[model samples]
Target: MRNFLYGAITSAAIATLTVSTLTVAPALSAERLSLSTWGSPAHYQVAEFVPMFKQLLEEKSDGDIRLKTFEGGEMVKQQFVATAVPQGTIDISLTTLDNWSGRVADVGILTTPLWDKSMEWTRDNLKPGNPVFDYFDAKLRDEGAIIIAMFDIGAPVVSTSFEITGPEAFANMPIRAYSKGSAQVLQTLGAAPTIMGVGDVYSGLQRGTVKGAMGGLGGAVGLKHYEVTSNMFVPNGVMGTLIHAYVMNKAKFEGMSPENQKILMEAAAEARDHMQQVAIDQLASLLDTVRENGNTVTIVEPGSPTWEAFAKQLEPLAREATQSYPQEVQDLIAAD
Candidate 1:
């Protein structure tokens, strides 16, 4: 009886070890893909996104493909990720489209009020099919990049050294804005809008070149701008914008085995969902951090007379900026 028990124990141990080895094993063919993005290591997207992708990709590829990441300036300047990916200098880049607006005009459609509520709208309309992805997939494919997964960075809010309590306040300040919405939103408030790079915003604020800016919470913290200019004006008309992308070089993506490609896509789609949840959670934390640092937070009420008045004033620019997309896309979102 004792001998029988010993034999059973030995068998169970071997089975457990076999399973462990299989679970942790790497693929026979190992390939490392390098990814780059314009975010500093401290950037929320990078901190939350990079490791999640690496782990998911590794598990999906069953260890066959490993992602190597180069962040901050080493991979090329942060804003250059989209530009570099086309050249194949970097296999993939996590990017913000606002920076690439010059190259792809419709890309900014989401950045403006046209798609302000698009997070819910797009998911409601196009998740299973992802037509926007289809549209952009083709657009990006032509540039030698493929969009596999994406998420919103959270709505961008305008933070400033100056307070913009009313239209006049908004106007007198030649606001440094991010994408087309920034231009439209600030312009409606009666301010001159200048498209400014993320890196340039700090200097612009400090030197009084820009009295204020429209940006997100993470951006203000990451750039250390709160240290200089400390008021946050949160507007209801799309204070946030979506961000995050996991893309691959066209040639590299196509080179993957069909089975591996499917595996990668599945993982990426799941990651996209994870990213969206993270953004929503982080937004509150980011706001708390701003206040803890001694900055004032002003909530811009949605659909108030002030908001509607601003929108009415800037409707023309909004319409022109949103022309490339279906008018309904903007109207449904703008309607509220």
Candidate 2:
């Protein structure tokens, strides 16, 4: 009887331990996600959006979800983030629509100077049910990534070693183009456009390989283009805006619980709104900084003669660029 009782006790203890281990295993296991972006730690997407996303997700998930972030091209370069996210190399990524343009031609519509809308206009129109947003979102989804949020980096500006007093200034000027749309714009303006990466632009300007570089004002300041270039032309709503989209791997996103997916979407929208306002404020301040640094900053007011002249010059190119897109998209641009 004593031996039988001892054996029974040992079996009970084993069962209890197994049950305890099973109960605690799930509690200890958390889903760790990796996010990558090309922006440096100082970039607004890094400084503002990333932390907001991490905090919201961790808190909402009750620590079940965690994020490992790579910034400043640590995991993948900016141009490759679109591919990396879908290929499962990255769980989430932030990249410009221009990077995805080669695969999804419809996205190139936004990169062109066709839309003379202000930042506010763009923001108001980029919501669900909006034809433009739905179109691009569907196109990206077909490519295996889902856009969680969209925000403007800033308005496109040209920083050159020489002053841009008039359209004539761009004649025969060699400038670095960040996208094919920008290249078309530059070429149409009689400027020689050289395709270049953002990282090489400062050096390109410094070495006189490119006399001017087309980019956002924030990028010019963040990358310290002021040190290498002398003038910045803010085309006010003339050159269109630079927009960045935050995306997630579609398979991973679909695999999440609906509640978690909702939480991610909410967090992304909050972060995007916060970043947009901060970007506006930062752009204004950075413009003042550029002026204070003894660099000439020119603003082409939307209705000014210079603006009208530029609008006229680029209208033909804009129409041509939108030819491949759907009629609804072309109408949207024409209406905008």
Candidate 3:
């Protein structure tokens, strides 16, 4: 009986050792992820957040997961992220919802000039438990992708060769439009809107093909749009925020262990907060960069005669574009 008890204990110890070996063997080999972004290396999306997220993920996972980054369309074009990520051409991609707006109508709402809330308001309202965010998650999941985080790209301004002091000043000027909603807004203000990518705006403005371009403060400075434009018209609260989302392939995300999944998500939230705060903190400096580059900055006061006229025309145009959303979604978005 003593020998039999000793034999049983030995077998139990061997079984436990084997189970431990099986559980830890996979972790010894790192899982390599191909992470891509459309932004240039210096852009905050790539510069500030991507590295931080990668580091956090790898460290927390003890090098079990590794992120290999592709910056500035290295893996694919900016607009192809949605398809690429799901097809496994890339594991993750950072881009704005506007890139896939053609596939998801609600995605375009992020780019529409209808956002009147502050960044803090937007952050709070779109948190995990919020219906607004839940709606977005459902919409994205249908596309075989998941949004890890969303960020504000700051408000865009009209940088024009001529001054836009009032609605009348917009007459007949050819402005570069970044989105269809923006095009309608410009048209309502009597400006001829030409559609083009932000990257093309510098050359378009420089070559006199377009008199002005709608762009974010950071983009104008980063892309050097100030070199060609003479004026920056910050049209009060009417100027909408350019929000960006960090998206990952849903299947890939689901394939990870719950701990790694949580690690990735937590890192994303931190990166989102860090990026937005950095952008907000750098707004003054970005505007100063514009001025130093020889562009005059004009802030149109809210509710002023000029502001009222622009808002009156723009609000209806924006609403019409986003009318497809349920009333609740619209109300939630438009609400304070």
Least accurate 10 contiguous residues by lDDT in model 3: 120-129
TM-score of each: 0.80, 0.89, 0.85
lDDT score, candidate 2: 0.81
lDDT of 1: 0.69
| TM-score, predicted candidate 1 vs. hidden true structure | 0.80
Per-residue CA lDDT of candidate 2, range 86-176, in tens? 8889999888888787888777777777655566765666755666677778888899998888777777899989988667789999998
lDDT of 3: 0.76
Measured with C-alpha atoms, the lDDT of residue 167 in candidate 3 is: 80
Q: Where in model 1 is the C-alpha error above 4 Å?
A: 1-28, 118-128, 184-188, 238-240, 322-336
Candidate 3, 89-181: lDDT as tens digits: 888887666666666777666655656667666555555666666777778888888888877766678888998878888899899887665
Query: Which candidate tops lDDT?
Result: 2
Which of the predicted structures, 2 or 3, would earn the higher TM-score when compared with the native? Answer: 2
* Highest TM-score model number: 2
Question: Model 1 Cα displacement at 257 (Å)?
Answer: 1.6
